[model samples]
Target: MHFDLPDLRLFIHIAESPSLTQGARKAFLSPAAASARIKALESQLGSRLLYRDSRGVELTPAGQRLLQHARLIMRQVDYLKSEFTEYGTDAAGHIRIFANTTAVTEFLPEVLAGFLAERPGVTVDLQERLSRDIVRGVLDGAADLGIIAGPVQAPGLQVLHFSTDRLVLAVPLGHALAQRQSVSFNDTLAYQHIGLHEGSTLLSFLREQVEKLGGNLALRIQVSSFEAICRMIEGGVGIGIIPESAARRHSRTMQLAILQLDEAWAVRERSMLVRELDALPGSVRALIDRLKQGV
Candidate 1:
């Protein structure tokens, strides 16, 4: 039995996306065309691949097995293209990275800007995820690299120290808690909070902490970036938990107060994870080096 690369790619997209229509759009195929192709593939394999429903599609057991092999093949194909770039080929390189909220918002922008400027032929798809999810994404080959925080437990993946990330409480200058040097997370729960948008790793972590303490986070507003959260806090809309770097930087120009968190989880050691370091493409490796330099 022969499996076509395009068919496998389409299947991968379908498995990753929420719906067949969205997957078809990603693969640049009309819905009918995508369905026909999947039918043909299922016929060739003599097994059902996906479960269709009104909500979305779910992969069958057979589909999961196929997805494993498909991802491996696609990764190899990408590596092949990247390797050719070393031999005077103009094949563009693409790197996928999954990172935590702090790395995404505070650390990566400047570093990626410089890296992308220097390598016009290289492209990066950077996503923000929980640190645990970042590890899973890298280990599953969904991302070429992952930037994680706090304790790491990736058994076989190569890990490197990235940077230190600390969480802090930001309040308006005249707020009652502003005079405090530090405070427990639960202590701040009584006041309204400016939080990062939903799905942010930091927000998720804060929610988890609040749940553990049997308290609810009183989120006054949810903003897209740490800077926005700082702005909201400065305006006395609410106080917020944000990275120390962001709180410090914004405090210089905004009427905000930075208070250290008293919990052990507040201070995190960030690290980078890869399935294999030497196996990474040259461009991906170079970007890793740049990150290590804190540039």
Candidate 2:
């Protein structure tokens, strides 16, 4: 059915929120205005698109089918706008990127610096989020790209590996394990451990690895940020296992020590994740190409 872009966007927003009022708020339109748009769309398509009840609005069969096509059309429209605006310039446009805290703090500076040097007009907006949230942002079109820890399983996205990082054990300089060249997972369980908060990918990965080894991690404190975890470990709250790059940086600033985990217990992977590989804008594509070349 022929539909204007604004009405389709309103419909998709309604489909996602399922509350006319909530959708209107998100779309920054009055409820009446939003409802009118939906009605106009329904009339043009000659079908009832929504059913309202005490439980809020539910999409009809036609609405469900149209929702899929609507999303695709909206994405293409956005891409087309970005493409036209970005043409004939040195990657001049906005690039919204979502990366995990560790990447934001430790890994992305060099890459971002280099990217900006090459494409001075391109504005880069980067935010730190959890790995899962990073993936969601990219898939939902809220972010142009994301860099996070690997092995994320999500459909309709392409994953690429650019670098490998290992989880290292960090402790106070005076901790008994500080001098050890390497320690095992069981060795870590002996001490009180500082860890990332529950929903974190690092925490979940460590938990799974420990569980697979028929053991459980004994956490003394669960902090929300890597920087906080490092600060706590440095203050002697407890030892922590964090990405090697993060640990190394903290080591330079504080009296912290790091030891590589035993090979079997070490969780290491090329820092990788999924994104729309083919749909990336020129600026994003340039950055991805550099990453692929290990630049």
Whole-model Cα lDDT of every candidate shown, in order = 0.88, 0.78
Worst 10 residues of 1 by lDDT: 83-92
**Which whole-number lDDT from 0 to 100 does residue 156 have in model 2?**
64
> In model 1, what is the error at residue 274, expressed in angstroms?
1.1
As for candidate 2, its clashing pairs are: none
Per residue, candidate 2 scores C-alpha lDDT tens digits across 208-294 of 788877987889999887788889998999999898878887778888888988855365554445455676666677777777777
Stretches of candidate 2 exceeding 4 Å from the true structure:
12-19, 39-71, 86-90, 113-143, 152-156, 263-267, 271-276, 293-295
Clashing pairs in 1: none
Candidate 1 matches the true fold with a TM-score of 0.91
- Candidate 1 scores a C-alpha RMSD against the true structure in Å of 2.4
